[model samples]
Target: MTSPFLSLPGAVGSPVAQHYGAPVAEQRALDAGDAAVDLSHRGIITVAGPDRLSWLNSMTSQQLLGLAPGVSTETLLLDPNGRIEHAIRVVDDGERAWLLVDEGSAEPLAAFLNRMRFALRVEVADVSADFAAVLAFAGGTALAALRALGPVVEWADPWAEVTRGGTQYANGEHAGAEWSAVQLVFPTERLGAVARAVAPAGLMALDALEIRAWRPSRVADVDERAIPHEFDWLRSAVHLTKGCYRGQETVAKVHNLGHPPRRLVMLHLDGSEGELPVAGALVFREGEASDPEARPVGRITRAALHHEWGGIAFALLKRSVPADVTLAVRAGAEAADPQAPVEGVIAAAQEMIVPTDAGATRTIPKLKRL
Candidate 1:
């Protein structure tokens, strides 16, 4: 399908309008629920048959056996060691269960499901080509507009609180308690009509807001070594009481007797220098970056100029890094326009997203003196 955003002014990216023109303004609009994001590039898959929910419950990290229609939840597909491979947002509508994932994830997930189907009844298909998604926050024009596209499938984010049988590794109330992101699915052919009803913003707008909410994304935050514990993902994606599935051993072991070696943090960059470090910038302790012998303790995964927060980012750091110490993110020379380079270390204050004491729920009893 040709992008409805292809010809949009100030649009530039894989499709168009990564930001329509004014990114900060666009972000403000999005926060106020006035705009929707064009997500034609995202992947959508469907699982159909009488055994759909039960089969999925037996394979993934979330409990889906009796999932009611219209409820929104997410699950993670983990490798044997409990390393995250895919993060999937799911919704069932009686006939079939929909799996919404980041771009490039639909094909592999569907293929894996196909091979696992032995007979009992389940069908998997990547319908990304035929269907497209529109992203919106609750109670806004974009959400209302999408609802007008009736008989549509919608999935609201389950981030405001911990789900059933889930544990929140992040202490205190969730920063995103009021967050209300929703995805509306529509036919690819209706791109033109949908575009006309909802005002469009770029993906940048959506991402900036997510950063402020301290949301951990699979594509941006996960590495080959990433486990659900590192990003505090158990709050929404992992069910502690669910029956055994792949990677259950590691998930259980870590929850009971271990801690995630790495932890996710929200970085409050010193925007006084007028520079925001790009993703992958090196993170150091205070003034350590100047020493050639000193190694970075972490790396920025996502950075954006938030509408309300200014320059901020999400970084994954070694859990041993002291929480009270101010950190540094080195924003190097600008390769795009080097005339006035942004060559300097940006001071960062850490906001703990995942605490160092996040896990180890069980205590081993000491043996009595013999």
Candidate 2:
């Protein structure tokens, strides 16, 4: 489906705007629930038939059996060793379960689910070409126009706080205490109707808010070795005591008797140069370049210039990195001198997201004799 937003002046990139010229204002408006974000690039999949919920509940991280209609939640598809494979946003509309995912996810996720269908009475279909998703805060100004699409399907984000059968790893007041993100899915053909109804906010605006919310996305944060504990994801996506699922053993073990090898941390970047480190940039301790062979303490997964927070980013760092240390993000090596230190890096401040002591809840008794 072609994005209706492509024609708007100053709009750039695929269906969604990276920015509409004035991104700061757009960010403020979206956060205040006064504007909408174009997420047409995302994918939607539907699981139909009576066994949809239970079948999914059997394989993923969430407890989805008997999931009530209109309720929003997320789940994780993990590898056998507990590494995250996919993170899916879930909502059921009485007739079928809708799985909303990032753009590259639908095909593989559908194929995987199909392969696991076995004797289940469920059928999965990738309907991304038939529909699109738009983001708004609950009760936002854009709703009246969007609702005109005739009972558009909506998925309320459960990230404002922990949902049932979940856990919170970050302590104290959450920055996202007021977050009320909602996704409205409508027919792709109605794109023009939406374009006429409300103004568009780019992905950057949406991303800044997500960073402030400390939301962990599959497309942005997960890596080859990502686990639920690393992003403090057990709070909304993992059901600790639910029936068996893939990666359940590792999830239980990490939470019960071990810590995630890495933890997610926020990097408050220095934007005085109007620069934000691009995603995948390496993060290091201040002046750690003294040892050219030293490994980065972490890698920046997402970065954005916020309307209020200036330059900000989210990184997955070693769990042992001190919480208060000054850090740096190596944007890229300078072209003139690849070995030059201090040429292409930006200093950063470490804002702890996942706590250092993130796991090992069930203590084992120690014996004096060896």
Instruction: Give TM-scores for every candidate, taking all chains together and pairing residue i with residue i.
Output: 0.95, 0.95
Residue 94, model 2: lDDT of 96
Report lDDT per candidate: 0.86, 0.86
| Worst window of 10 by summed lDDT in candidate 1 | 333-342
Candidate 2 backbone collisions, by pair: none
In candidate 1, what are the lDDT values of residues 1-370, reduced to their tens digit?
6678766777777754688788888888888888888888889999999999999999899999899999999999998889999999999999999999998899899988899999869889899998888888876677877788762699899998889999988878788888899888888888778878877789889888888888889888788999999988899999999879999999999989998999999999898988887777778899975555567899888888998888889999999998888998777744112233335788999988899888899999999998
Which candidate's TM-score is highest? 1
Off by over 4 Å in 2: 289-291, 333-342, 367-370
**Best candidate (score: lDDT):** 1
Candidate 1 wrong stretches, greater than 4 Å: 333-342
Q: What is the lDDT of residue 76 in candidate 1?
A: 95
| Colliding residue pairs in candidate 1 | 11-17
